[model samples]
Target: MGFNPKDAIESVKDIATNAVERSADIVESAGYIIKGDVSDGVVGIVSSSMDIATHSVEKIKEIATGRDEDVDEIGG
Candidate 1:
């Protein structure tokens, strides 16, 4: 089959998502190790922030690549 641009874009998205998730995990782990009990609140905030950042990145990528689909959903 010929190269499909959509599939390539999806693959790139998957890679970026994995990288962001891994970074979040590392940050959470470090927070826990450093803050002990207080890390719970900090981790929650960090996780949500990461989710928003990921969603924003995806929207930017979609716009940059000229994908016209509406991105009304956040952290899907």
Candidate 2:
């Protein structure tokens, strides 16, 4: 076997290219996963905020009307 510099350089280039391509694919997949997780988290926060808003409004209404019925209903 002969130590050919040209062949060694070509082989190194090919390996580096393959490694870069594989790394890019992994990074792309991870980006998609992170995006999905952020989307789900935003939806959860929005849903919780809406629920809190509705409950607050209901409580205010009950207090303004001096209603004991709502509290009694919950206790029952």
Candidate 3:
């Protein structure tokens, strides 16, 4: 029987994908597009690093407490 190159390539791809997903530090891997008018306007984008450990916990508390007013104070 002849050797199949296609199967070998697929196996390698699967291994690489698995390795990437197994890492703990990877939170999300997605792209987002911001569509808006920036003509003659100043646009600012803010972001927080993944190292903020308490951020997730605080958000959970805000949700559970059901405080819309405090939501703005948290990070909104």
Error (Å) of candidate 1 at residue 53 is 0.5
lDDT of each residue in 1-76, candidate 1, tens digit only: 3345776577567757776776776677667667765667566657767775776676555645445344453335
Q: Considering every candidate listed, which one attains the maximal TM-score? A: 2
If the candidates were sorted by their lDDT against the true structure, best first, what order would they fall in?
1, 2, 3
Best by lDDT: 1
Candidate-wise lDDT, in order? 0.63, 0.53, 0.37
Window of ten residues with lowest summed lDDT in model 2: 60-69
Q: 1-76 in candidate 3: lDDT tens per residue? A: 2234554455446545544543222322111222343331221111222323334444444444443235446555
Candidate 3 global TM-score: 0.28
Against the true structure, what is every candidate's RMSD?
7.5, 29.3, 18.9
Q: How far off is residue 6 in model 1, in Å?
A: 21
Which window of ten consecutive residues has the lowest lDDT sum in model 3? 40-49
